[model samples]
Target: MPLLPALAVVLPLLLAAQTIEEQEWHLDALDVYSAQDQSRGDGVIVAVIDSGVDATHPDLAGRVLPGTGFGSSKGTDGTTDVDGHGTGMAGIIAANSRNGGALGIAPGAKILPIASADEKEQFALDVVAESIRWASDHGAKVINMSLGFSSSMTPSLVKAVNYAIEKDIVLVAATGNEGKEVSAPANIAGVIAVAGTNREGKPWKSSNVGTDTVLAAPAVSIVTTAPESVYSSGYAEMDGTSAASAIVSGVAALVRAKHPQMPAKDVVNALIKTAQDLADPGRDEATGFGMVNPMGALTAQFPPVARNPLLPEPKPSTTQPTPTLAAQQPVQPVVEMKDRLPFVAGVAGGTALMTGLLIALPAIRSRRREPVVSARDTPPTPW
Candidate 1:
């Protein structure tokens, strides 16, 4: 077992319940969790790439690991919680705090945190790319990314996700709070795009949409944690897909807990196909596969894996020799997300834009050089 990392820096808000019970409580009980529990997602490794989890929170204390941080205030012990967003996200995914047990989708799972808060365009791209590659190569079965860039795809991150897929890593991403443009990584193919839905089971007005979106989860009125300093308004009421994305990631973890053998993508597919229809007769822009149905996805029988009986005719080799694993050196863990944190946000348009731009300068320069390896190196499975 090694380490593999992935992340999302976009921190929107999520609606939370003060004491747990609310009119929309059952929304969090969607099949994504129960299915994983029924199937056993508790045994898997769910890497949370975000601001940094408050590992001391009663609900998530022991369940989270100080894997690494990608932001400036690097912690020797891994508790990099500053903005309060990461703690909230971690609560949704693996929080087991008693009373505050807040109870994650998969209670038995372990979380690996990769902390990074910088959000400039180039910095964001490089941090995300490095995080994904780190998690995949190290041994993360599932990588949860709750954020992404607003513009088109960055080659590095895109390649990193592609490499993760090759390694059979499952990637989950937030649909974005702005909702208008399809955010990078989420919009990219082979990666699972998770959108947000309110208690009424309606997609959040701000949640992004796309045909490629895999499923929508409870985004509004979702309960979680916040940094002590973040509550200038007092009691936190998170209200965005950021929370929903955590819920989805938790379910993905529980799925691995139940069925350790199933790869990340298949688990994602199960949830996608099993999702309950929320909008029209079938799939639509708002609710891709509908609210994630843990029960349905867990119990739903995946189509039997059938091998293509006849092999496709082989194409003639162009000219050069195909490199083998023996010829290539073993992939080394790339630590691109250390002190140089990618700008998480504010670079697009904000007073702090210059600061973000300055932070992103190094990452941009790194991109100018040859890619360390493929976007993400396909590390061997660690389970």
Candidate 2:
């Protein structure tokens, strides 16, 4: 099967555990247990954009908020997960395990389901864009997109993403499960692209890789809620980057809940900066910034204000004076060494002449009287 087709059929594997024992290992890996003590994604709404959600699932009872549907299932009511994929994704995000099912990363968060795909499990880019805009406009703080296309990013999707960002919505998408490049919507800017990792903190063989990937989450043999029709039992084990994206979305909900006033950009930066490094010291194409750490992202202190990269930087003041060519040139001082040299030479010559005259006058004054008497006596003796 081709990669995308294979992804469409990636179904859940039934585990023998009669009662859903909490998938504590994956939660521990994300540090979700510790984070819950601080904030369990309370009062936060996460929009799940996928093949609808099982609104009546046991674990998801009363947690799913009313959401609109697009595509073949067109309406403002009744978001049902016939394919079972959206229900599984929602379970990973906000399933209430207290009722005897698997625990979600943020059990306190509420899910807003938007069915963008049809019964055939086909997603149209235009429908996906419409769903995103609807979710943002309808009080969704975090939007989880576990579905994507292998095709390039379309302008409609980009416009919807911009709309969400403008509304301070945190968007997260799954890097495709094709073992190749990340899928569109995830490839779009301002989306938190998530990859999949195993229990050993290594990249899942099937999870896609690309520069846009921002974090990794448990994706191998993961236990989550399943649709009753798909699995008579209410829970099943699944693996894919889709599950990973949902987990990261849950973490985003926790961050948003803890810091209610935080901007969407800082929420992303907190998750990226605090993720545990795996495979590489920093961010890598395979695992992005490494596995997502829920506790770290929630507890980590971030700067209150951050600049939006999409906006232009502030320009310098126009009233500031501009320097002319002459003002710009460096100034050099001139010195007249030739004029000072003659004055220095004359002072030395005068000092030397005064010393010589003083010595000759002292000798001549002492010998003058004796020399005149000797000359007169010599002349008398000769006569």
Candidate 3:
């Protein structure tokens, strides 16, 4: 099946009359307005690698930069969207408040649209790899991959991803909508894998979950731009991890714009550290670190890291500094209780109840562990 079909498109009228604030619930959920006060992603180029993006759309008119198309999409530039998926993803990242239409998380960010697949979705893995390389070379600071494959990563794609990372490009991708293992590209190391969350901040039922997931964002009923042919209003409600990934990509753009001096590694660190924890607390497979908090990501204070945490640690060198007496001693791992306090408290309470049960066992022998029900135990009849 075409992965593009994974997203469900609602009626155009649903967004035709809705106000900007009313239509884009994700903005309020992530406190995008407050976050924008700090940075609107200006000077950041976010490349949307998917189907084509409709540049003519009111919300994305001038925000879309000239982009290229591959495979069957080569007939036109990456400006015409045959499938509305790319348009939706682009709007989520950089749509402006034109015609009172949908608003994006980083309205000032420019979208570098790369059409990897046409309407048939016949694009190969090599095409995706080529697109990544193109985006990296073309001044794209952040690349939004709202598409994925069920197959394993190709060698060429892996090299392309590494190339982008080496160039300090922030890669973000959706964790897929199959409710299975995270799809390739997103599952690849060093990529910010985004999962889906509903308006209530709970995990979206259809969102794929895995240890690779990096963050969750609003995916259900997300209002974004679409091709005019797809929706007369030039907008529609979308549902999938595709939208979630785009939302996180927008936040990454904001971070890049706000801290132009910050390296890609630090940008990734800031986003992961500032997210709001959800579900099982502290980096669970369902929600990763948690929902991507724009305000926190934009304004929160945190230490800078030496490297991207998503990538594997480098091997230790043979030559090492002479160990001091304190260094020779084993360093105790510091444990933060706030994350697991609830589970720890629950376990303690359960232990106390078990002890009480053991103490009362001798006195309660008269009662059966399981309630007995016999044919004679029928309810009493009315007079």
Candidate 4:
């Protein structure tokens, strides 16, 4: 199986037992309710590219749009959850608790579930790539991928990711749960790699860390919706970087909805800029910019940038003929998020917004940060 296993242990919770306050501690950490008051993610479409999503779940009933699925014998319309993982991710992003059930961070947003992985939590690398392109062409503003491969990415997969970036789609992925290096897709340039944080506001012991990590969110004891058949109570408690990724995706929807005209790059910029710093001064592998601050992301003001902070500068062309003295003059390199630190620090040493216009900022990160490669033994065939 190329895809990572279910990121968390799914434990069924009694429907009548704990209230939302008792179960969803992460929401309070994010101040999601106040953020929602500003933007409930209306008019935004988030594509959940995962195992599958149970659209019929009470909390997700009318919130899921029609979607497509891949692989053999997976004749589902992207509305069925073979392993309940996708359903959980979808719940974390856009569950609508009209009937007093699980209330998601972006309750007004709609989900476009793409079922590319199989029941055993296995994903064909090609299928995942195809799904990314499909989502981009189908009008998805944000794509959430809770699954990842620890190995290097294939060329097609990388191309698919770049295509989405070019189309202005915000891509979010889990950094894996191994507590080792970050994984493919998430580690790919221009993608927002997310690490997991515990309830105490520290990095989760098992969330992978690396230069690619852009943000962290609560992944401990997350309460989310589940397929009725998979969990007797129609809800489950779990923990993993997968859940953290979904939390960021939900916040992204809110940002997009609040600023409908904001480019995808700026949407990403707002997230990284507004996050609470939880590690060494600035960005750190353990917690990236810090825990996601939903209220800050929504209410705080920040000047938009011409490029996504996560991306790197593009390399110059080599085949061009030798230029004249004036043309040969040195060209300024694109200012990357890391390289822009001095500018940001000079203004506000903390998370304050950077003012003034930044010119010639490259659109995406051209350098791909490849993690140490290793393959986990594949699980035995279910058949």
Answer with 2 or 3, whichever has the higher lDDT: 3
**How well is each residue in 209-292 modelled by candidate 3, as lDDT tens digits?**
899899999887777776767655465566678889999999999999999999998999989998899976689898899999
Query: Can you give the TM-score per candidate against the true fold?
Result: 0.72, 0.76, 0.78, 0.78
CA error at residue 18 for candidate 1, angstroms: 6.6
Per lDDT, what order, best first? Answer: 3, 4, 2, 1
Residue pairs whose backbone atoms clash in candidate 2: none
Extract clashing residue pairs from model 4. Answer: 311-365, 312-365
How many backbone clashes can be found in candidate 1?
46
Candidate 4 per-residue lDDT, tens place, 1-383, comes to 23334322222223234453346677878889899999999999999987678887877878899888876414667988756778888989998764445779899999998988654345655677889999999989999988776555666677788788889999999887767788767877788999998888989887888988989998777777777676545666666788899999999999999989999998898898888999778999998898888888877777878667777654466897643222322323333333321100001111112233211121110011111111221111211
RMSD of 1: 13.3
TM-score of 2: 0.76
Per-residue alpha-carbon lDDT of candidate 2 for residues 2-91, written as tens digits (9 for 90 to 100)? 987666555222222333534445876666778899988988999998768887886787788888899777874535876666788888
- Which candidate wins on lDDT? 3
Worst 10 residues of 2 by lDDT: 363-372
Q: For model 2, what is the alpha-carbon lDDT of residue 196? A: 88
TM-score of model number 1: 0.72
